[model samples]
Target: MKIYVVGIGAGSADGMTFEARNVLEKADVIVGYTVYAELVKKLFPEKEYFVSAMKQEAERCRKAVEMAADGRNVAVVCSGDAGVYGMASLVYEIAASYENVEVSVVAGVSAMLSGGALVGAPLGHDFAVISLSDLLTPWEKIEKRLECASAADFAICLYNPSSKKRHDYLMRACDIMLKHKNADTVCAVAKNIGRDGEEYAIMSLAELRNYSADMFTTVFIGNSMTKNIGGKMVTPRGYKNV
Candidate 1:
């Protein structure tokens, strides 16, 4: 009756936490988005699996809960930190309706954290995580958040930057940010972090509008004081400068 919700850490098998991997090895059934399921196929080659595409999130979590309700150990996998825009919340929603189902969450490295590590400590201070996907949230709300994050000078990490259906949102977001930040503000687009086709580039807020971003990309925009040194992007914590 235990359901382990494991954050698979940006779809990198190597990024899987030791505890998450142990749970995966013992799980009788695994459930996740189709792309995430495929990314971890090697770990659960012999286990029962359920994969769902976009917008079928509720159904996928229900299936996992059903299996767990039947006394099977299930692992619900999610890319990045499960709690941050991952399956953890959806799983909790379904778990609320059930009784006697033990649910545990295992943390993994999220793309935002990985991307921050790749650059410098842009996140050493306060930061905000935002998703540009308007499919679930209103565009006005997303825009408002972007404006607030920029105004606060909080380092921003963006997930689900762009897709075939929603291509111009990131550009639009940058345009809004420019009002609060300078043109020289450092930014990074970390694509497919820790996975194949992984690519990342550092640029300025002004240049962000020119890039072709995709769903796999995690964008990091520096604060007002962030700077680039020797090709590495860094947001100093004042200790170094003091």
Candidate 2:
């Protein structure tokens, strides 16, 4: 039994890579969060589907494994890069718990990458990806990582920025970043990147503090070198000297 954990990249069919599309086309069943399941359903109208709510990681992986054990070619769908804050780890964990269930991860463009592209090359150099969600991790730990990343001057791509229950975390994170970075530091928030309702707003760090953000938003905090040009955000790769 084999399962392909494929990242669909922000739930846009156009965002799916060629390899990922091929894997999905060959899959006997598709398993994923409800949103992702709906996105891919039209493509595989005849294929069987297994869906779980958004945050049901353990149950989702267990279901995938169970289906695979029944000799189904299941494709566990994820938004953004499966390996980047997606279902890849959960699938691997469940596979490791059992034996003989073959699992493969098909990478997709992460929110960091897709959102960065929407706002020019904000991640032209070294960067760190962080999630603001404290459900599984402590807020103290999340804050520590943000502080460390800031001190290191690394470009930061933030995931799970704001949610219904966790409303003020994004603003708090912006305050922390402002303490370490200048007010003029470039910052951008991309909402629903590569999907419907897609939009991006580029601004300075100070401005970002008051910017409207939601759980669908991916925030990019630039390094000292980042800049905004012609309404597009960019972090120069430093090839000019060469």
Candidate 3:
């Protein structure tokens, strides 16, 4: 009974890691959020798929564990790295009760990495990855993280920046960062990364506050040392003058 937690990477087959593809191909059952499952389906349509709605992560992982315990090789798929705000932890938690199941995690390119590439090397130095979704986390905690990351001058990558229910969350997050960062600090929004209609834009912290983002958008806020080099957002790693 082996269960693989696979990261599919940015909703495109091109972005998937070799290890992730291999695990998905070998699995008898594929389980994930409906959107993620559909992405995997495009690559491996013959495999059995089990999909659930949003906010059903626990239920989904438990079902995957059950299927694994039934002697089926199962792969629980997620967009981006499964360990990063994905289904890996929940799968492991559920598999703990199933003594016969062995769990393996396959890494994939996360949005921060993919989005960063689209906008040059904005994350060349120290950075923080935070999620603005307050469903599982408290708003105060997210605000505090934004404040701390901004104050520390770390480039910040934000996941789940906005959704229909949380329309103003990204703006509020920007306000927090503005408290510590200059208005002209470089910032960017990477939308639909690796998928169709992919678009990205570079701007200042002040401009980003007025921008609109959705669930598919990943936001990047550059640190104090960041700058626009030839129209690309870049952060210096202090390797010069060596």
Each candidate's TM vs. the true structure? 0.96, 0.96, 0.97
The 0-to-1 C-alpha lDDT of every candidate, in the order given, reads 0.86, 0.87, 0.92
Candidate 3 lDDT over 1-242, as tens digits, reads 88999989988798998889988888898999998999999999898899999999999899999999999999999899989998888888889999999999999899999999999998999999999999999999999999999999999999999999999998999999999999999998899999989999999999999999989999999998898988789988874622
RMSD value for candidate 2: 1.4
Best by lDDT: 3
- Cα deviation of 221, candidate 3, in Å: 0.2
> Is 1 or 3 the stronger prediction by TM-score?
3
Q: After superposition, how far is residue 102 of candidate 2 from its true place, in Å?
A: 1.5
Better of 2 and 3 by lDDT: 3
Which structure is stronger by lDDT: 1 or 2? 2
Tens-digit per-residue lDDT, 47-117, candidate 1: 88889997898899999998899999999998888888888888888988889787899998988898787
- TM-score for candidate 1, residues paired by index: 0.96
- Better candidate by lDDT, 1 or 3: 3
